[model samples]
Target: MKDLFSSYRIKELELKNRIVMPPMCQYSVEAKDGIPNSWHQHHYVSRAIGGTGLVIVEMTDVEPDGRITDHDLGLWSDDQIDAFSKIVKEVHRYGAKIGIQIAHAGRKAQDAETPVAPSAIAFDETFKTPRALETEEVKGIVDKFRASVRRAVQAGFDAIELHGAHGYLIHQFLSPITNRRDDEYGKDLTKFGVEVIQAAKSEMPASMPLIMRISAREYVEGGYGLEESIAFSKVFKEAGVDMFHVSSGGEGPIGAAGRPGTHASYQTPLAREIKKALDIPVIAVGRLDDPILANSIIGNEEADLVAVGRGMLRNPYWALEASQALNKKVAVPVQYERGFRH
Candidate 1:
């Protein structure tokens, strides 16, 4: 039987355990230039030292206007690359694989003169109603995503995950309610998502894995459902996506139904369904705090990986503690050895 601590390899990267520090926005970057500072470096380095198998960096905007918050990290230029490279090296020293989630906020971009999306839809009260993107402008966003992937590879990240989920740029395109364009982009729901994957792949090293974070269900009327999400997964697989990071909600009409409440393994069923439909590995996320529940998801073939966000934020050594509870040995940094022994 495979244990949670069992090593798993995807392409050239090998995870030390099944634990993944799922991307969580820190909102802790330089506002003007969106460069990662010392705070970002130390935060991720600690997680690496805490024995996380894969430390996925927060959602990094591919362009200035793509930022969801004023303090989001970005990789739109050469200067930003140097700043992020420092943290990548530090995380690598702790023996963990690093991945960057490159994204565009689209209509969800906050505090911008004119946020761009497939249509002119506002995400919420906090965000401004976005300007519908022109066809030429849409092409520019694709180029930016490709460029960002190149920068991430140059910064020495082991892999890059395209931030397609969570009501971001790709989600804006995927949801019918948000994407009302009559052109090529909206006519084919899967077209834009597949293009981003291809563009990112083109800029990255051939051996490096590319994961697509997807909102498996919109959980609202006239929005993407499980059937459409499953069909979309096929397009992603054909586009060379190595894994599917399954998440739900965040892209729907105001006050939609079926939004999963905060509960243990709340989103595991989405992962299970997607995994059943696709051959690629499925990563389950959302309120996955308990080791028993995580073990059950993996043990029952529900998901190949479990991503813990708030849980890990509250406890950097959550993976280590969970491993101990499961009677498995995990690497502990020398500095934390005393606490681990106790």
Candidate 2:
């Protein structure tokens, strides 16, 4: 009878509750350099005050050009580490574990520099056409990932999640529609992902949990399918990924079909299937607005954890309210107790 309020552990990390706040791009950074500021602190701190068990920071670029937008956060230099450290400390003070999503936007990067992908492909009209990365430069991107992981560790993050999904850099490599290179990287999509994981693991402590957010299905022609994702999951497991955040359908023309809709647990099946194929934990996300549905997925072993994105955004106290509905005790900030007394 594991409910939404039940405690869960992934690797050595313990989550006070099953409710997790999925990373949502705030696009609130100060400038193209991607340095985190007070806005990020206030944003995440508000979520922490809302009683989320875990709050995964938004996607942060490992390199300057890896940013998806000019306002995305980054960790390419030592100066950024202090801001991240402040964020981690603030979130932890509220009893919420904080994790950072380190990523490269790849072909999706937009701004001063042209984007780089496994092949020269464009994301959409809003996205800039990217140049294919050279072999040596690709290795540099892997190094950048390792460096970012090190910075996250220095910032005292509890875990690190590789942004492998959402039609970003890693997704670009994973998707056949964009990754048309014949080299080892483009020829074997799994290899590139494995390398990134290996690099991150090498830089970060072995005890720290490593999760990969992957689109289980591209939902477009010639894009990644569940079968390929399952295979990729196996490789990730062997490479020491602690969990898989199963999200889908970010790989087509911009605003293509399969974007977020009203369906509850739209990507749960992918998590279930991947979890069945691998021994690691799977996180189900997308339209998980109902606590009953979230509890059912966990109770039935469909997913080990449920991530709520827009749902939590619309109602940061969604977890606390859910606990109340399920007859479970939830901690409320003393100042807010009066508001909930009714």
Candidate 3:
């Protein structure tokens, strides 16, 4: 009988409510040195003030070149830890827990002079053909992942999410369409992601939960779908993943046979499938802008949490508004009480 307003917990991470603000890339860093600036501070802290139970910072890379753009965030260097810590501290003040999505864009790194991938695949004609990582180099990237998670741990984040969806580095390794190598990593599609998961967990506190964002189905033909994803998800679960952020697409361009998910809660069924099939908790995302629909996902036991992406971008206080609309009592700042008077 839980709804969006219910508190939830896993291991050490406790959320005050079920509303999550999923990681959406800001691409707003000014230094081009992969450091988050004032923009990120205001962006995240505002959502925390707006009543989000959990606010996941965007795709932060493990290396400078691992980013999609020069402006993206990175935790490769210890110097970058303070800026993130500042955000996490302010978010905690507002009673919302914060998490960061650590990732490497891989072949999708738009600004890399030369990108790296599981194989030498160009995302498309417009993208550069990527250099495949040598077998030894793949292990090196795993170390980089471990380092990034370490920095996040130092930054005081309640949780960490490894991005394995959206045709990113981890996704590139997971997909047969992009991974054509004969190495052990290619031989076992889940190896890279599994290693990354294990490494991230090593740096996290025993109570801190580790979440992974994974595409449950690839859109392109010949690509793996729900069944294949479930198999690999089980591998990740055994590898120390506490939760799954179920999403779809990102392998290739959507074709006639592989259309994008456009309807509201279109991706909720996929989350439900994984939760039932694997008995693992999942965060249902994708066009879940309506608070009522998001709440139902929780009430129906469809998902453990619901992430509102674009809706949050449009309204930093989307959670607060949803609470009002749902007639659910939620904490509002004393200063903003007049504004939210019912």
Candidate 4:
């Protein structure tokens, strides 16, 4: 019987447990050159030391302007590769598998001189309206994704996750509410995402599984729902996605109809549904701060992995604490074993 302490395997990657520390941007890149600094090193290494099975690094953009902020991490240069490699080595020493969430912020890049998106639209008044990408330019973005994946592989990451959620560049191309282009990309909403997936796959090793994070339901008016997301997810799967990280909303402002409530394991059901419908593995993330609930989701076969977002932020040792609280015999570091007795 698999539980939170059970080891899980996907392709060539084997996790020590089911507790995943999902990507949450640290925004500590001091030089604004996409290179990660000491803060990133300490932040990720601490979680690895705390017993997380998998620690996914935050949304790292493929290009400088693709970031949500100037401080976000990036993978556009060879110079950035060495720094990420060091972090990956440290996390591995702690026995936690590390992955990177390669992303593009699109119109949400508040600091970009000229943010680019599928269409010339602004997220809101505070954000600048992005210039629409020409058909030829779209291919360039796909190449950038391929380059990013290559860099991740060189950095020694065990897995790769493409950020297609939260109204980012890939999500912008996926969402009909945001993608209003009349070009081929708009004609086929999944085209951009599919191309990106294929591009990233080309650079990945055959043994590594590519994970995609997607908004299963858009909360804003005229946004997509589960059915549409599943359809696009199917396309992505065929295009070479191995797992789905289910999340919701982030298309527009909160509205009566679009607002999804804040509750524990609220997104687990969506993951369950997708897993059953598509016969694919899933990672359920939301307010799953409680160990019992997170374990229950895995025990019930609802999701293959549980990503604890805010809980991990508040406490880097959330996984270690959960192991102790659940009375599961997880291996604590030799130095910290005295602090966490079974």
- Candidate 4 versus the native: TM-score? 0.98
Candidate 2: residue 139 lDDT (0-100)? 88
Best by lDDT: 3
Q: What digit string (tens of lDDT, one per residue) describes model 1 on residues 236-305?
A: 8998898999988777531112344456777788889988888678888977788878877777888888
Model 3, runs deviating above 4 Å: 254-261
Give all candidates' CA lDDT scores: 0.85, 0.85, 0.92, 0.92
Please list the residue runs of candidate 4 whose C-alpha ends up more than 4 Å from where it truly belongs after superposition.
Answer: 253-259
Q: Give lDDT tens digits, candidate 2, residues 80-153.
A: 89989999999999989999999998887777378888888787777778999898888889899999999999
Clashes of each: 0, 0, 0, 0
The TM-scores of all predictions, comma-separated, are 0.96, 0.95, 0.98, 0.98
lDDT of 3 by residue, 36-94 (tens): 89999999999999999999999999998899999999999999999999999999999
Per-residue CA lDDT of model 4 for 94-198, tens digit only, reads: 899999999999999989999999999899888899999999999999999999999999999999999999889999999888899999999999999999999
Prediction 4 global C-alpha lDDT: 0.92
Which runs of model 1 end up more than 4 angstroms from their true locations? 253-260
For lDDT, candidate 2 versus 4, the one ahead is 4
In angstroms, give how far residue 210 of model 2 lies from its true place.
0.1
Cα error, candidate 4, residue 21 (Å): 0.6
Task: For model 4, name the residue pairs that clash.
Answer: none
User: What overall lDDT, based on C-alpha atoms, would model 1 receive against the true structure?
Assistant: 0.85
Sequence-dependent TM-score of model 1: 0.96
